[model samples]
Target chain A: AQSVAQPEDQVNVAEGNPLTVKCTYSVSGNPYLFWYVQYPNRGLQFLLKYITGDNLVKGSYGFEAEFNKSQTSFHLKKPSALVSDSALYFCAVRFRPGYSSASKIIFGSGTRLSIRP
Target chain B: EPEVTQTPSHQVTQMGQEVILRCVPISNHLYFYWYRQILGQKVEFLVSFYNNEISEKSEIFDDQFSVERPDGSNFTLKIRSTKLEDSAMYFCASTPPGHSTNNEQFFGPGTRLTVL
Candidate 1:
């Protein structure tokens, strides 16, 4: 079975400083990783994804993620954090070659990111 | 930008009652999905629909759960019987065709269901 793990339940970073949220996964086949952000009382917003391209993948809201195959990790990163960026972040993984039986996109437990001003 | 839209932002119902959560996905999308999140819990995928039929479903999607695309633009999830544990924020999502690469899913605000 495929699964994802977000080691941190919460992460705190000062505004204007760089921020990193860690994520790792376990899958039998190639992994399709993605990051999403959710604000209070709102739906989840897609951030970025890692398919089979360059290691560094850039996404919405000045966010990016690095796909490290050897480490089995895809960590979200932002060079400069903003107070408005505070939200719950989720890491998801899916298997390529179409895992329709298992419904690709198994999400992690989620990480609460707080940007301190 | 176009987005998925859900109706009945909040619904309160008694146990054993039938409730249907409605959603309007982005035009021209071919795939639809339903997911639920309990308070303080991870999001769980209930089912996925494509071409007017259920392509995949999870264990959580038992006999009590069903999905239908009554119209060209509307997708609905119906729970035959409401259970206490069913109380949670139900999200509806959709994706376009030939999108198996990253499988980016656009979500709606979601409907908060409360079972009494």
Candidate 2:
């Protein structure tokens, strides 16, 4: 079985400061990691993903995540946090395709991020 | 870029009544999916559809739930009998071909179903 864990329930950071939301996973095979952001009353928005490439992956809204295989982690990061970036962040891991796109991904419990002015 | 869309931004129905949530996937996507998130809870996958058939479903998807691609552009999820626990935000998503985490899904704004 594959699973993801977001250790923090919420993170608070000052606007213009760097922010990092921690995520770690447990998977039998190579892990496929992803980050998504959700705002009030909206659907999950894709941020970035780590399939197979450089350790760091950049995503929408100037957000990025680094896939650290040794640590079994994919941490989302933003150098300068914006008040607009405040939202619920989710860490997801891809399931084996098994020749189909069904059961594509499983999400973490989610971490709420707040940017303080 | 074209985006996925869902109908009835909010739906309120009495318990035991049947309701169908609709979705229009991106024109070029090959895979479609439905997920639900209970109030203040994690988002949960319900089912996935492709080639006009169900490709996968989570344990939460029981006999009361069904999915159909009635038309080329529309995909629907039907709940035969609603329960109070079923009240939540339902999301619809779509993905293009060539699977991987990188093949990101486009999600609709979502439908908020309130079962009473």
Candidate 3:
């Protein structure tokens, strides 16, 4: 079974500092990794994804992620964190049996990021 | 820009009662999905629907759960008999048709279901 792990339950960062939310995944084959954000009383918002190609994938809100094949990690990063960037972040892995698109996404437990201004 | 929408932001139901959560995906999306998150747990995939049929489902989506797209726009998930453990936030998502696995799903604000 494909799974995602976000080891950090909470990450506290000061405003204007760089931020990193770690993620690791396990899949049978090449993985399709994604990052999503959720604010209070809101839905999960798409952040970014790593399907193939360049190891570094950039996404919405000036966020980016690095996909390391050997480490099986897709860590979300931001150059400078802001107070508004605080939210719950989730790392997900799409299960594609035989590379089919008709599949489900398995999400991690999620990490709560706190950026204090 | 178009976005997915879900009805009844919150719902409260009794055990053994039936509850239907509704969603209207993005107009041009071809694939729809349902996911749930228990208060402090991971977001889990319950089922996926395409062309009015279930393309995939998880073990958590058992006989008690069913999905439907009765009309052209509305997609729904019905729990025949709700249980106490069924309390969670249910999210509806949709993705446009594309080549292999590169598409990202757009999600709607989830409906918080509480089974008393």
Candidate 4:
């Protein structure tokens, strides 16, 4: 079984300040990690993913994440925050080992990002 | 840019009634998926369809749930009976084939189902 944990229930940041949303995971094998954002009453929008290349993965809307194998963490980061960036962010993990068909993706509880103007 | 689309932005159904949620994925997408999120809960995968058949399904996708790609572009999820717990936001998603890296799935706006 695979699981993701978001340590923070909510994170607040000021405009123009850097922001970070923390995420950690536990999986049996190599992990495929992803980040998604969702506005109120809207479906989740993909932000970025970490497959196997560089440890730092860049994503849409000026977002990026660092995959730390030792920490088992993939924390979302932004150089600067904007009011419009306020939304719920989720971290997901899927085990990718030997191309097993029964593997399923699992999502974290979600962290609410609030940017102050 | 092309994206997935879903119909009936909101649906209200009575208990024990059947309901169908419809979705039209991107023209070239080969995999379709259905997911649901209850208020204040995590998004749960209901089922995944590929090659016009169900490739995977979760325990939540029991006998009451079914999926069909009746046409070339449309994908549908049917629930035989509605329960109060079934009231939630249902999302439809699609992904193009042959991309093992990332395997990003694009999601639709979602349909809010309210069971009375």
Candidate 5:
């Protein structure tokens, strides 16, 4: 079965420091990787996706992700962390079975990223 | 920007009772989907609808769960009989018509269902 994994349950970084939220996937065929962030009491916001282009994908809120095919990892990153960037981050992979035209998103357990002053 | 919208941010229901969660996808979107996250759990896909029919569903989307696009603008998920385990944050999503791998789904804020 296809699945996503976020090794860290929580990641803490000092404000203005760089941050990384790790993610890896187990799936067959080429994978469509995505990053989503959820704020308290808010819906999941799409951050970025790696479809077929460059290994580095940029997204909203100054967030970016690096898609590494050899390792099957798509890690979310930011050059400088902000308090407002603290939220739950999820890594997801879109999978479509060989026989099915419809695809479903398999999400990681999620990692809570906290930025402290 | 156009975004998916869900009704009733929260809903409380009793076990064995029926409940319907409503959503209005972006006007131009043709693919709709429902996903749920149990508190502290990964988000799980329930079902996907397209061309006015269910295109796919997950194992968790048992007979008790059904989805429909009742009108031009409203898509709904009806749980025939709610169970305590059904308590979750249900999210509705949609994307412009395209191959599944190419379209990125836009998600709604989600409805928190509390089954007692």
Candidate 6:
């Protein structure tokens, strides 16, 4: 089956420092990658996505991600971390349904990002 | 900004009871979807609806579950028989048709279903 893996159970970063949450996927054909975040008691929020363009994809709240095809990775990154950035991060991949169906989106286990003040 | 909205932020139901979760996606969106996340697990896709019909569904979306776009504004998920294991947070999401740069699924606050 197609899936993405988030190796880190949790990532700790001091406020003002850069942060990274790793992700890698295994899927056939071109993949559509996305990053989502969930706050305590809140729904998942869209962060960024990588469709078919440049390797660098930037998203909400000063967040960004790098798509490395050869490495089969799409890691979420932020130049500087804020305490507010602490949340549960998820990496997702959408399996494009050929020409007759809706896309099935798959999510990674999740990475807890704790940004310290 | 227009966003998806869901009813009954939290729901408590007895096992074997039927439950319906309601969602109102953005007025202009063309695609609707349902996803659930058990406490510490990944969010799993349940089904996708478009043009008043189901576009796709996953294995978990068995006969027990059904979706209906009752009107122009509401899309609902009905679980015929709720089970204790069905407790989770259910999210409703929607996205536009085609692959536009803005074609990202917008999600609602989600309804937490607790079956006892």
Report i-RMS for every model.
Answer: 2.4, 1.8, 1.6, 2.5, 1.2, 2.5
Return the clash pairs for model 1, or none. none
Model 1 C-alpha lDDT per residue in residues B45-85, reported as the tens digit of each score = 88888888887888999999999999899999999999999
Runs off by more than 4 Å, candidate 4:
A96-104
All models, DockQ values?
A: 0.60, 0.67, 0.71, 0.52, 0.77, 0.57
lDDT of 6 by residue, B8-70 (tens): 999999999999999999998888899999999889999988788888888999999999999
Question: Residue by residue across B11-116, what tens digits does model 3's lDDT show?
Answer: 9999999999999999988889999999988899999888788888889999999999989899999999999999999999998987326688899999999999
lDDT per residue for candidate 5 within B23-77, as digits (tens), equals: 9999988888999999998899999887888888999999999999998899999
For model 1, what is the C-alpha lDDT against the true structure? Answer: 0.91
- Candidate 4 interface RMSD, angstroms, 1 decimal: 2.5
**DockQ-derived CAPRI band for the predicted complex in model 1:** medium
Off-target runs (Cα >4 Å) in candidate 2 are A97-103
Chain B TM-score for candidate 4: 0.96
Error (Å) of candidate 6 at residue A85 is 0.3
lDDT of 4 at A47: 96
Name the candidate, 4 or 6, with the larger TM-score value: 6
User: Model 4, range B26-100, lDDT digits (tens) per residue?
Assistant: 999887889999988888988878787887888999999999999898999999998898999999988876653
Candidate No. with top TM-score: 5
| Candidate achieving the largest DockQ | 5
Given candidate 2, what's the lDDT at residue A67? Answer: 92
Report lDDT (CA) for all predictions: 0.91, 0.91, 0.92, 0.89, 0.92, 0.91
2 against 6, candidate with superior DockQ: 2
TM-score of 3: 0.97
Instruction: Give lDDT tens digits, candidate 5, residues A1-117.
Output: 788999999999999999999999988788899999999889999999999889999999899999998998999999999999999999999876665556778899999999999
Query: TM for chain B in all models?
Result: 0.97, 0.96, 0.98, 0.96, 0.98, 0.96
lDDT comparing candidate 3 with the true structure? 0.92
- Reference-based lDDT, residue B88, model 3: 99
Q: Determine which window of 10 residues in candidate 5 chain B has minimal summed lDDT.
A: B95-104
Tens digits of per-residue lDDT for model 1, A48-79? 98888799999999999999999999999999
